[model samples]
Target: MVTLGLVFAGPCLVAQQAMGAGTDEVLQAQLTQIAAQHHGKVAMFAEQLNTGKTVGLDPDKPVQTASVIKLTILFEAMEQVRAGKAHWDEPIVLKPGDAVSGSGVLMFMDAPMTLTLKDALTLMVILSDNTATNLMIDRFGVDAVNQRIAWMGLKDTHLYKKIMKPATEPMPADQPKFGLGKTTPREMAKVMERIGRCELAAPGEPALPGDAAICSVALHMLRNQFYRDTIPRYLETLDSTEEGSGIASKTGSLNAVRNDVAIVAGKSGPMILSIFTYDNQDHSWTVDNEGEVTIARLAKAIVERWSPAGIDGKTLVPGLGLAPVAGGGIGASK
Candidate 1:
């Protein structure tokens, strides 16, 4: 049975004065209420773009970054192109060895296929294509990717290897292999800030030589993130029916973890948020109540608190089916 422990850590509200006076208290209170109910650790960071005010719960705590690491890959790939080390349209062939078993369309394809660098990137982000990711990792060595992270002044973020590769296969036994990359909420948000400001691949350096074109492409890819299915639907209320008002974000989930990070363009300014949850209680990916509810409840609470007016009248997203547990009831089951 899945036991639910809901805890709200409350918002850190760091650098609050810059964000204005009353906002910090409200955010902190809300986050605190949310963190009190959970059993596992939750690390999150939210930054208001205009004032650069930020808040977090264990913001610096390192967490297993699932697909979010792809953002780093995307940055490095674009930087390579900007430096004239590679071309966006350059043709590359996909071989059998590049295929990985989970989450992507390429593994289903059977023949020696080819795609341009730009197309590969599109597949990587849009579909979370593992095959394409491995290929890119091969092209740009892991060392190069980590070098960029260091240059950006992010100490807790690093890319160790490809996610699709199994740890037991051929690589050094001592090497970490559960995921391709890892990062803390604080570090991840910093990268998002850099990308938002177009300072990632600064010109005339080892990465991208002062070429704004490269930065422009990177920005476009982020803005066009393919996975829109998981963003809390309530946030959509503010969005125009034609032009959704919500932000572009990514979702990552594995056996024992689920994560969502967003760059929200709010009324004040853009905000970068990274929420990570890890549960060791149940490692099964199939249907572990403890693990699923922990993440679902947290995500729901965030959406509800962040946009309470929008969600008060609506139903929770279908799968979660989490209504408030009145009188300690289990709420509605899915």
Candidate 2:
């Protein structure tokens, strides 16, 4: 029997906050009330890029990441392309055995079809395609993704295996605890911050020149992410399919868990929100799943508190207008 009171923690668990003076105590109070009212455990970390104001609940606590770990895979693909190790146009073949049923269109498509590496990656992000995710893992290797996570100085984040597949190597003691992967709210937010800032290289490493192009493509997929019921539920004003949205996000879900990490191009500045909910009593797979709504409420409160004027999609197109990074020719979404 599962319990709703479990609070997963890691050795790195410590109070993490940098809210400057005049911090929004009311906003924090609102967040606390929202978390307490939910029928599940919540962990979150959010930061405003311009002011560095932040609010968090168990920011460093490790939790089941579900499909959210795909962000690391997407990150690795970007770095590999930047490092000349992989090409976006590289061909990837998907046989019948590669198809796995969950959340994607690839399983219903004809088998043995060929797709470019970029296509698989886009599906992995926009649609959360499990088969597409497996193709990427097979091409790049899961260990490589973990290596990149380590390079980013994220200790609690790990991509344990591919989607719906068994691990062939030795398993960690906590393998069964977090099915596909695991991460802390703070660590995952760090990943989004890196992409938002277009800072690809690891800390202290010489910056990779001409790598802003890589960030553009990654952001493009994230901006077009198909699952919007979480963070984007109350943030988007226009149909993202037609006009594009100011939110670039990736969401993950399980029966009792829902997670979303996003980079928002707000009116004031860019903001990053990483939220995870677990031990939820509501396990229904409906749009109104309690965990999902909980995440959206948290996001709405945080964004409303910080960017009272709302988000600007225009800033998103130019890579959040981040310094030393500019626009690129991103392929149109299918």
In terms of lDDT, the best-performing candidate is 2
TM-scores, all candidates, are 0.72, 0.89
Q: Candidate 1: list runs displaced more than 4 Å.
A: 1-23, 166-178, 201-213, 229-232, 237-246, 280-334
lDDT of 2 by residue, 1-334 (tens): 2111223243212233344463565776678678877877888988898887877877788999988899999999988898899999999999989999899899999999999999999999999999999999999998899999998999999989877788889888998999899999999999988888888876677766667678878888898888999999998887777666688899998898999999988888888999999988899999999999999999999988899998875447434573322331132344
lDDT of 1 at 83: 64
Q: Against the true structure, candidate 1 has what lDDT?
A: 0.60
Q: What TM-score does structure 2 among the candidates reach? A: 0.89
Tens digits of per-residue lDDT for model 1, 1-334: 2222233343222211223342444665566455555555566776665664555666676778888887887778866776679899998789877788777898888748998888787777757788888888878877889898887788878787876575433443424643566788878877766666566445464444455556545544554455543344334443222333335455566676767676654433455667776654456565343434454454445544454443321121111122221221112122
Which residue window of length 10 is worst by lDDT in model 2?
Answer: 2-11
For model 1, give the RMSD to the true fold: 10.8
User: How large an RMSD does model 2 have?
Assistant: 5.4
